[model samples]
Target: MSQMITIELNGQQQPLPPGSTVNDLLAIVGSDGKSVAVLVNDRIIRPESRALHQLQEGNRVELLIFAGGG
Candidate 1:
């Protein structure tokens, strides 16, 4: 079994499996990752890097989603 790690997701505590990447978190959150900006420790994570960027314990993550309205 994989150990879980806690991270701050938009100011709340989010538990994720160890070795989870940005893309993994997106999937877990039911997000398709489109029109969403992800930041880790105040650093912007590019879309191409999301799959390779690994999240660590106690990391601060902020997710901003863009919406279109007529």
Candidate 2:
């Protein structure tokens, strides 16, 4: 079995398997990366870094998606 870690996402706790990359989380949240931004542990993560960044235990991640309002 793969290791699992607890991460906080948009103020909610989520369990993710070890070796999971940012792309995995983006998929879970149904984001396409075009209109979304990611923050990890209070630091902004660049889009290019997502594919290479692996999630760690007790990480605080926030996903902000763009929405149009008129």
Candidate 3:
């Protein structure tokens, strides 16, 4: 079995598999992938690199969502 790691998600601590990537985090957060932005330890993550970004222990992650308004 893989070790589970804890990360802060939207201010709450969440447990994830050791090998989890940004893409996996997106899935956990129920992101539709259209109007969302991701940041890890204050670094902006491009959409194309989300899959390649590997999360580490005690990494600070922030997720932003853009909503359409008139």
The lDDT ranking, best first, is: 1, 2, 3
Report lDDT per candidate: 0.93, 0.86, 0.84
Q: In model 1, where is the ten-residue run with the lowest total lDDT? A: 27-36
For candidate 3, the per-residue lDDT at 50 reads: 85
lDDT of candidate 1 over 1-70, digit per residue (tens): 9789999999999999999999999999887646789999999999999999999999999999867778
- Give the range where candidate 2 is weakest over 10 consecutive residues by summed lDDT: 28-37
Task: For candidate 2, list the clashing residue pairs, or say none.
Answer: none
- Local accuracy of candidate 3 as per-residue lDDT tens digits, 1-70: 9788888876778888887899999988788555688888888898989888888877788898866788
Better of 2 and 3 by lDDT: 2
Q: What is the lDDT of candidate 2?
A: 0.86
What is candidate 1's CA lDDT for residue 18?
A: 96
Query: Which rank order by TM-score, best down to worst?
Result: 1, 2, 3
lDDT of 3: 0.84
Clashes of each: 0, 0, 0
